[model samples]
Target: MSLDYLQLAGTKAKGKRPQFFADSDNERLLSILMAVAGELAVTRERLDTLERLLEAKGLLSQDEIETFTPDSDQAEARGLLQQEYIARILRVVQQEKEALEEQQHCQSNNDLSEIEQELSRI
Candidate 1:
């Protein structure tokens, strides 16, 4: 199913390139949120779906499921850390987009490229 966030005027985000969508700051934050959330939600859903399917198909036993806890303490801690990281990023991108919109520039590349850049740097 299409996501609710898909209806938002956000998908215009591309890059700092000369393309029109590339230069839009309007709803860039929204676009980013939608893209990332959609991916994460799909992943979570797929994992859960697969878990159920495996159980039904006898490909995985109950003990296997019990051992494979994505929500375990360590996994949960990491998830929380990642969530905070993304939330902080989106917050910054969102505020920047709003500021740019107020100035009518509405085209600042979301300037949200730092996080991914840093990740790639690592």
Candidate 2:
């Protein structure tokens, strides 16, 4: 098994991506979503580089970049990234939540700050 992060979604022998979400509600939509996500990621990186170049050339200011907000489509893309992120990390998040609940029950009725202090001592 190769542990390549970029190929986690898998690909064919000819460098084509395999449809991992074929059984999804709308396979076409899923494929498009994945394509859009990939494109948006690349576009975002390129935009960041462009902004840095502009700033370096004194054409754009740091404040302008810092205060920038995405338009509706970019905002939606961010939402998609957030959803995909939750899907990716849900299991670990659940496990951590369960562990925290267990620790809360096992420990006294102290607040989280007290628990942190106790943990730091350990």
Candidate 3:
């Protein structure tokens, strides 16, 4: 079975993100760190599986695996994967930033209304 890494990476989770820490920034950082840890764990498992399969078939060796290099197209695809991975990890931060911007925008509009009200009384 083939996995669509890019499509899966781009998918956003629905519903509000729960916070375990008092500070939202701490929560965001925790999310990012956990994502990194989870990615590392999955990658390690996949590498182990590949190594075992190759050894079983006598198709690859440790030295060859270490020295293997990708062609240009493969390199570009790997780069895209890396970008998607990073984006997934940073999603929390991006959400927080958007929320804060929206809050500030609303506050500015409210402030403008207050100023206009005061000006009308003059």
Candidate 4:
């Protein structure tokens, strides 16, 4: 069977996520920033490759690439791609937020149990 990269990327590992910093939010932010950086690096490399290939094939020049502007449809398509790219980068923050909310819910339940027990003693 062919590998499904999108599925693999979305899958969560079985074990607890490792924390590298004291604050979990900091770690999540760092993950998001790193994802952005990685995406930018890959995009830059791919763009450069495409530019080189086009120039070599006598189809386009570096000056033309620099000055080219997308029309309405192309711009709309790129806007959609940008939205998806941003969502991918922010996935870490979203996951962490959900995990934090779950933790707070569990803590609230435990606190409620303790309060009930204390009320019973009074």
lDDT leaderboard ranking: 3, 4, 2, 1
Best of the two (1, 3) by lDDT: 3
Give the clashing residue pairs of candidate 4, or none. Answer: none
Superposed on all Cα atoms, the candidates' RMSDs to the truth, in angstroms, are 15.0, 18.2, 4.0, 5.2
* Residue 78 accuracy (lDDT) in model 4: 78
Q: Please, what are the lDDT tens digits per residue for candidate 1 over residues 1-122?
A: 12333223223344552323555565565556665787688779998898889989989987887876565787877776566546543653655667668766433334446666878999
Against the unseen true structure, what C-alpha lDDT does each candidate score? 0.60, 0.62, 0.84, 0.81
In lDDT terms, how accurate is model 4?
0.81
Give candidate 1's TM-score: 0.32
Better of 2 and 4 by TM-score: 4
Model 3 superposed RMSD (Cα): 4.0
Residue 43 lDDT (model 3): 95
Clashes of each: 0, 0, 0, 0
Off by more than 4 A, model 3: 1-12, 105-122
Residues 14-116, candidate 2: write the lDDT tens digits: 5543555646346545655665676679879998899889989999898988898999999987777656544433333344456689898767656766989
C-alpha lDDT (0 to 100) for residue 21 of candidate 4: 100
Give a tens-digit lDDT track for model 3, residues 55-114: 889999988999999999999878887888887788777666777899999999999999
Residues 2-82 of candidate 4: C-alpha lDDT, one tens digit per residue:
124333444555888778999877998888888899999999999989999999999999899889999999998777676
Ranking by TM-score: 3, 4, 2, 1
lDDT of 2 at 36: 64
Candidate 1 Cα misplacement greater than 4 A, ranges: 1-26, 59-73, 80-122
- Sliding window of 10 residues with minimal summed lDDT for model 3: 1-10
Clash pairs detected, candidate 2: none
